[model samples]
Target chain A: MKLLTLNFLTCAIKTCKTNSASFPLHPRDAELEIVEADVNLPFLKNILPRLMWDELRGICTELGLPELPATPPTPADLIQPSSSTPETTDAAPIAEADEEPSQTAKDLHRVLLETCIQEGKLVCGACEHEYAVKEGVANFLLPGHLV
Target chain B: MPNPSTPAQTYETNHVHTVYEEIASHFSSTRYKPWPIVQTFLQTQPQGSIGADIGCGNGKYLRDKSQVWMVGCDRSTNLAKIASKNEPHSVIVADTLALPHPNGVFDFAICIAVIHHLSTAARRVEAVKCVLDLLRRPCSSSSSSTSIFTSSATPSGPGGGGGDDEGGKALIYVWALEQKDSRRGWDEGHEQDVMVPWVLKQKKEKQEKGRRKKGGDEEVGAEETKQEGDKTFLRYYHLYRKGELESDIEQAGGVVLESGYEKDNWWAIARLR
Candidate 1:
């Protein structure tokens, strides 16, 4: 599973349903890999607004990656410095530019696109629910009673 | 620990997973088109957001845009493999009832034509709750970072926000009454809870083997009368009525933002507050 996926997961325990701290499962004993994926700058721009910008920054910090801005980058923030197009680039529109991707865009690309969690365990902070990650897949199933 | 016996659940799960695996390749070819509602929902989302498609048949939603990092998961490995090959998103083999993600993690989620496949009404609600749980909730006051849902909900005004803190939103579609409309030629007699049949295509090798066996028989048996290429597999489904979906969302503790029918399909947009 990609570290990107860990953001959405939480303790599957029924008791944890009302527990506010059941999320952002802490990755423990992780085996990380940086795999090559086609960088979609437009997609990255699109997800910024929807992402838990603080949580994402925390995860990157935990993984020893670059920090994300406190607030997600807006359309104007993402405009490529070399963008010669009259229309500004936002998450939706990918302006054709001769220059390289902006530093922020590159960092976003690395965290969202390249990082993969090949093996690890995500232990919930509140209930101590341990979700095992093996071969890049996290097993979220609880025992019969939990369901 | 000894596992509890759940024959009904086991049988239903096995049946549905098996059918999908059997027809995954064929199903992939037929699922190329993206649903308009889903596309529109995606358009509203911010770029570089993370999302998941539960029971994503062929990862069709992943191809919509690049800004969001989408993951496609299904209980069937065969379908996940096809999705991984066909779409750019990462694919995982996981069950919808118990997703692997931490609670409140996504900006948006898409569960197209997935929930109705659950064998039981209780499970259907559970599935919705599970998706709701995966959405990212709001942080406490001390946190400097903002939940994307809150940011997006800002434009809609305070009252319009889907949920208090679990602002992550979702778009869910299920089998609806329009499928049974008389003009569509579907049998109205079909019950809401019933096993739907999927015709399996015969492999060439199997056809050749059957031909050899037929030559030895003096009379063609009635049991063998089935067309050489056609075999039926029963898959379970619990179709939802017009209001059942919104009711389930409410029952699951979700705040319905908007809901209604589009032809035979019923869709709901809600926030897991």
Candidate 2:
């Protein structure tokens, strides 16, 4: 699992739904890997608003990776087509140079898209439930009593 | 494994899991492509929508659509591993009866070719309700307006103010025992709950292959050896009759928005009210 996905998950216990601590499960003994993916800027731009930046940063810190900024960049800054270039400012029908993504956008892309946890355990804060991650798939099946 | 004294349901669950694990690789290869009907259902969703695929073997449906955040889960760990290889960080090993997600978290969901695996009527009903439970209501702030309003039948409200304008919607598909040319004419007393066999092809060892003489002699020998090594694995299936799927969903508190037969399978798009 990627650190980005963990941000959206909470303890599956019924009562844990309302407990704030149930979320943002702390990563323990995490083994991470980096795989190259075709960065879809449009997709990243679309999902930015839904991500909880603080939760993402917290997990990144636990995994010993680069931290996300306190404030994520505005969706417009990421989505706006680079129509105005430094060369012409408003050039006519000429081939334009590819615009480089901002430093913040690159950092977000690395943490959210490039990195994945190969094996680990997600420890719940409220009930202290431990979910194991193996072969990149988290086993979330709780005991029959918990269910 | 369940003892003989245990309920038949427990034994059935064990049978399904064991068979899937044994044939995970071959099963995944056979299911290389998603059904076209399922692809159309996915295309209807807006970009950036959070979607879940319950019992998502091989994650075949989690392809090409770059805009949707698709999460996949399955009871089989081996199949989940193959799926996660393609979609790292998005697959989970989970049971459909007790999914790991919180209520009303997913904007949309799909459970294809899954419900029929349950061996009993009550188990099928439980599986259907579990899928419905994962869906977020249509009126939830995150849902797309186009999805709900497009349906012709507007379900009555659980909310006083015209009810909650939205309930969760899902597409469910089940295998049909006697649809089209799928089966030979059935006798009067055909069983609904049946054990279907999956035949696994076995590879012969070098010594065995070399022992065979050359020419047509080898051909006859190979045919006989093939029969000896063929392993047939049995899986429990409760094939849905026509109208049975829709009835199950409605019985589970889902409002049937639309339902019909597609290809050899029966499917329905329902709103959980």
Which one wins on TM-score?
A: 2
In lDDT terms, how accurate is model 2?
A: 0.70
i-RMSD per candidate, Å: 5.6, 8.3
TM-score, structure 2 vs. true: 0.79
For each candidate, give its TM-score against the true structure. 0.69, 0.79
In the range B1-273, model 1's lDDT, one tens digit per residue, is 213247655765567777888877755654665767888888777545567788888787777645466777887777776776533467776778767665555667889888888877888898899888777664334222333444443332122233445456899998775465523334344567767665555554554445456442211121233577677777777777778899999999898999877656789998875
Docking level of model 2: acceptable
Clashes of each: 28, 5
lDDT tens readout by residue for model 2, B1-273: 212233644665566878888878766755655677788888776555667889989888887556467778888888988888665338888778767676666667899988888877887888888788777665645532123322322111011223355665789999776654533333224667777766655654643444334322201221233356678777777777888999999899888888988766789988787
**If chain B of candidate 2 is superposed on the true chain B, what is its TM-score?**
0.78
Q: Report how closely model 1 matches the true complex, as a DockQ value.
A: 0.33
What does DockQ give for each predicted structure?
0.33, 0.32
